[model samples]
Target: MRQKEIQLNSDELRSYIDSVGYEKDNLLEQLRKETQDLGDESIMQVGSSQGKLLEIICRIGNFNKCIELGVFTGYSSICIAKGINDEGRLFAIDISEKYTSIAKKYWEKSGLDHKITLILDEAINVLDTFIDDGLKGTFDFIFIDADKSNYIEYYKKSFDLIRSGGIIAIDNTIWKGKVFDNDDQTQSTKTIRDLNMLISNDPMVSQCIITMYDGMTLCLKK
Candidate 1:
């Protein structure tokens, strides 16, 4: 039997679902709200629904060693950490120390600080270091959420670092629905479109882009 389809097209309905279906722990919830209160930068933080989904994915995959590009206040990091095994660790890379400071506070508050290592440097450079250190195909999960222009490159690096059965979740593929607008030839949009196409055609992995928050493309390494 087909399951009933429910739509949360309205803001009110979506908000209700966000509050009810994925009520984050108090510390995480506060960090999310506080980040949003910071204005446009708040969009950098993934939605509560997306955060919850990441956690669920981690738990289901038994994903322990992980990498997250773009720590943005650490909201997603905390979610990922929550679902990981107690001994699991996440290497979070971001360019801004200012923003990660906030994440640090919340991680400490959540008692998850020890589980995450925040790297203050260029994401690509960090990925290069991982490869230099001979750490390929070792990560159980990898999340790419930074520098839209380098998304394809990030995906490529992630592909090499992720284990055969591991998963790579790339956020912001839809580009606020700009991928469908041909006139919008912004580099970010163009790069995202290219990355989506590359992932679609690549035989090394099977993937699907889910319509959630901005859009998350979940890829399973084969």
Candidate 2:
């Protein structure tokens, strides 16, 4: 294949298709637009375009089980739930009942309310409970976009919950490029940078730090 052709992204390909008056072009574009409107403005919220790509990946994986460490306003949850849900189950943990109720509306609207199981509590506590209940290596996918300070803790728990050949994605792992910036040595950046190095050298999974919206470390469990 030619270099230019190989360089085209999913978005560029979609745009090219729309230019040719493809039948599904309008609907696809609309989906992109609408998702952004409902999504929150938090640093934690993955953008609509990226979220759409992730949702499609989850759908195609047909993963039966997923665990999400954070459910900030439910944008990412909605994206993941839309993908894998005939017999699938999503275990999402977050402490905010108020934010979750807002996400509940979208889940019901998408008719994916049953696909997700929202747990309102601390992540460490919930994960420990899952471990105690013999849920080791049960999940096919796990996403960690929560408290940055406890990233390593989440990584360890996710490693145990995810089955072999499963994928684990950690958001803000690059900390908006701040991990490399030595402007501050505060605990947050230090923790993230420390984990970045730690995971790079971890033997349990092969990691790729993709330079997406933020730096996303996508790990495939070995």
Candidate 3:
């Protein structure tokens, strides 16, 4: 059965956001522009709307200790930090020091450097360290937006990292809407699709997919 697929185009959506007074500061705008300069890699960056949603989630939940699996240029990192408690800390893990160096510059410019810790290493390794250090169930929020093929593994590990009633936001769950296209069996698409299904069926968490900006799956640990 096919579902009715109605959604605004990019221009219309941007216009709607503008009309609604979606505010963007120079720092975020500049970071976005710089990330865009990376060409296709820029697609890894989350949309402005997604960033705002993340910040809103942090605010409403009063999330303080957060973990972000991927810190591409730090756009979402800043957004998450903005809504966190004054003394909140964010652990951002990424494999690329080069990209994180760019993120570091903006993070300091935004005065968020003190709140964010950049770990340049494989996300899985860092997660293992968290477990080894007995830091399980210590985070208020966990944002997963790294290698698509490892999404399920990341989710499984992140589940153990967040506290009860905490949130885990998974990016690219819809995979540009490719999850619905059975013909598309690419590894990335398949993993995202499988992860979405896994979350939907998991009894330990309550979940929903925000359709805005690719798709972000918000899961609340029980």
lDDT of 2: 0.78
Ten consecutive residues with minimal summed lDDT in candidate 2?
21-30
Candidate 1 TM-score to native = 0.94
lDDT (tens digit, per residue) of candidate 2 on 121-181: 9999988899999999988999888888898899898899899988898988767668999
Residue pairs with colliding backbones in model 3 are none
Q: So what's the TM-score on candidate 2?
A: 0.81
Instruction: Kindly give the number of clashing pairs for every candidate.
Output: 0, 0, 0
lDDT tens digits by residue: candidate 1, 78-140: 999998999999999999988999999999999988899999999999999999999999999
Instruction: Score residue 3 of candidate 2 by CA lDDT.
Output: 57
Task: List, residue by residue over 1-222, the lDDT tens digit for candidate 3.
Answer: 999665744777667875674667789989999999889999899888789888999999999999999999999999999989989999999999889999999999999898899999999999999999999999999999988888988999999989999999999887788999999999999999898889999999999998877888999999
* Model 1 / residue 70 / CA error / Å: 0.1
Q: What's the distance in Å from true for residue 46, model 1?
A: 0.4
Candidate order by decreasing TM-score: 3, 1, 2
Judged by whole-model lDDT over C-alpha atoms, candidate 3 comes out at 0.91
Query: Better model by lDDT, 2 or 3?
Result: 3
